[model samples]
Target: MTPHRPSQHARRLVAALLAGSGLALGGCHADRIVNEAYPTTYQQRHPIVLSEGAARLDLPVGGGAGGLTERQRQDIRAFAADWRKNGRGPVGMMIPDAAAGVHSSPAIRNTLAAAGVPSTQIVSRRYPVDGPETAVVKLGYVKLKANVPHPCGLWPEDLGHGGGDYYGASQNREYWNFGCATQANLAAQVADPEDLARPRAQSPVYAARRQTVIEKHRDGEDTTTNYRQEDVEVSEVGGK
Candidate 1:
């Protein structure tokens, strides 16, 4: 009844004041209000290692030499197929010798592209080292999650060798192997399983002891790649 006594102009003025007050309050609590009222899409993509950027190539001799069998080539092709599904392809292939039957990086790139992988993802390199080398082929890709579990059983020791110091000073001789396995498993889970299998190689322990020796000499205190997962989370935001 009391409002009925007010003129239309007065009513409009009061309404305008109320609207202005509401807007001011909303502005003060903007972030909270928006967060509560309209949640955004909070998503995280997995990590991948690009062959084009981080790969190294050398002559495949003296510790890098081993001929890839037809079966091995097929396996590599299969692996490439899987990676292509994840919008990636083989970034690099490390053959023992440049003259070996192994295809050059460009050839591998073309082959992968024909098989459906994007051309930008392929890389090829030959190891340059000298003498009785084992054949090593490296494939690179990003990981899907921040933490992935490794399969060779965490911290297993070779009883035949000294414990805790088998690989020189490090407690785990298979650290890099385990680390790679862990990353591979995580990548497999996040990406397609097929792509995860392409770069598969013999376990570090199974490989010739010479490679182990080289790895030990190169250990240099650093244990794993940047993509390697850690035991503890350093950030508090994601409860990580």
Candidate 2:
């Protein structure tokens, strides 16, 4: 008599093992939350704006006031337009503690609003960390599907996948390392609409820098899991 083949259940277990291995090697950081859980795809396709050129409207840096020349102001206005077209605009603003006094002035609001951004979207908040008294201006644009896949949901890496890290334990912990940096990089590259249409390759320097950033940010960690026991059980039951 011919030997009996392993049952379908056994096959499924083997497949799961292989798939999990592939995910690990490919850096798939799966979150506990399923993709179906999200009610809307808004988060999936959201576009983040990047600050390009020099920052305009210098309030204060370190301890001194930052001066914006007339030419620089023009450049900033132009850059703001670019950001508006590509990213979600005027979402909000951030002020470092040192620049709090100057940024709160009414003149700054009038200037920014006159430049084309709506005043409503400008949210002012204390800088989360100590650094330059930079403005966290909200830029605007429609969301676009990620052209590449990402490992963890936290970041939309060039790989192409998307998801988020759903952890109850560290909900309050600072997870600064997310898709923001990638979105910013992509924003810089696609600042010009023409560049968005034309495809380009990452330079060696860029690749190196990207790798460094990913490592520093711990970009891929969520998808890691252990299904070895399940696989073993299936194999034992099916004798395969």
Instruction: Tell me the tens digit of each residue's lDDT in model 1 across 115-180.
Output: 666765655456653544444445655423223332434344344555543443442222323345
Residue 164 of model 1, lDDT score: 48
Query: In lDDT terms, how accurate is model 2?
Result: 0.48
Q: Candidate 1: minimum summed lDDT over ten consecutive residues — where?
A: 38-47
Q: Where is the poorest 10-residue window by lDDT in model 2?
A: 143-152
Off by over 4 Å in 1: 1-68, 87-90, 95-98, 101-110, 146-240
lDDT of 2 at 146: 32
Clashes of each: 28, 20
The whole-model lDDT of each prediction reads 0.48, 0.48
Give me the displacement of residue 90 in model 2, in angstroms.
Answer: 3.6
